[model samples]
Target: MDSGATSESCFAKARKSDKTRRSWTEREEECLIQALKEATTQGWKSGNGFRPGYLAFLENHLKVSFPDSNLRGNPHINSKVHVWKKLYGSIVTILSKSGVGWNDTEKTIEASNEIWESLIKVDNTARSMRHKRWMYYHDWCEIFGNDRAVGDKAEHFAAAVQVVLTMTPELPNNVGMSLDELFSVDEGGAESTSVSLTPSS
Candidate 1:
């Protein structure tokens, strides 16, 4: 019995399992994002983020969309969502900085090499974002922008809320409006109501 051969076979098996676990096609990501949007529309999402069981909903949705994907709610969908939130946070951080900006035409973050180097020093994850196209930036904003919570998870959400409020146009007869009211969509309407952000007394 060759122990070295046995160990190599075990290592190969582990690598194969990991590859299978990490495989996510572009179509699958699109499907997941669509499902998340649907979940938000259905009111599964709230101020604190998606309610419990949303993962199961997403898993079932993906299963129906791709019967052979074999994705699970526990790790596959959960891990992907976590990664997306982190990526979104990194992008938001990049844009929040004075030297960085978003390139609308290229759908990528725009920053000088010096700026990129500075950001990458603070966050190593930003390295991969250089000149990388992020097609789902707006979708991510829609999905996670309104999340209001305490601590680290809410950091990006708070920044995004500020950005959205700054971009929103003021309306006549606007005096006091809560964040919810500002972002609320009219009944049977596809667009969100535009309201100015006013400081609460």
Candidate 2:
């Protein structure tokens, strides 16, 4: 191969490796969730999802929180948000079905072996989620709960939100508190509060 071709091949391989190496630590994920909560409080979020440039805001927040992480908005932050939404949607679908339940304490889907067998038969993708533990489910709910599309799906999302609210006792003031108030009062506390999914007028 020519020297120019060899150089291009090496550069492509490096880029691919860098992309594949992107992974989030627990602290980094917490920071990301916090950043997203702050953005929602700032009214950058809408029913359809976060407004344009929110990814840049998230990138900057993560950069400040973990300077060595070198995360970018285009692929890194954007990809993470996409993944959270997809997973959150899947969990919502699972919980919306009959005979399926959410274990708030264990942060996992609760179902019988028969239920799993039936579900997997209909949707093979659900098989992987059988053993998955979603530690950040509530946080993702606060972020994407009200961001659902219109019609039947939106109603399903709302029902899932209600189920979460009923199961969660830590968020006593979920109703009246704005996202800003929720964050401010809990800022010094170890645990983050779940914001009300109702969009601000």
Report the lDDT tens digits of candidate 2 across residue range 1-201.
699999999999999878745778889989999999999999989766899999989988888978887788888888899999888878887787789999898899999999989888877879999878899899988899877542224433334455666789675764686544433443466433333444559
Q: What local lDDT does model 1 show for residue 86?
A: 69
Poorest 10 consecutive residues by lDDT, candidate 1: 149-158
Q: Supply the global lDDT for candidate 2.
A: 0.79
The C-alpha TM-scores of every prediction are: 0.67, 0.67
In model 2, which regions exceed 4 Å deviation? 1-21, 149-201
Tell me how far the alpha carbon of residue 197 in candidate 2 is from the true structure, in angstroms, after superposition: 18
Model 1 agreement with the true structure over 43-112: per-residue lDDT tens digits? 9996657899999999999999888877988788998998887677677767878788888888999989
After the best TM-score superposition of candidate 2, give how far the Cα of residue 75 lies from its true spot, in angstroms: 0.7
lDDT accuracy of residue 141 in candidate 1? 91
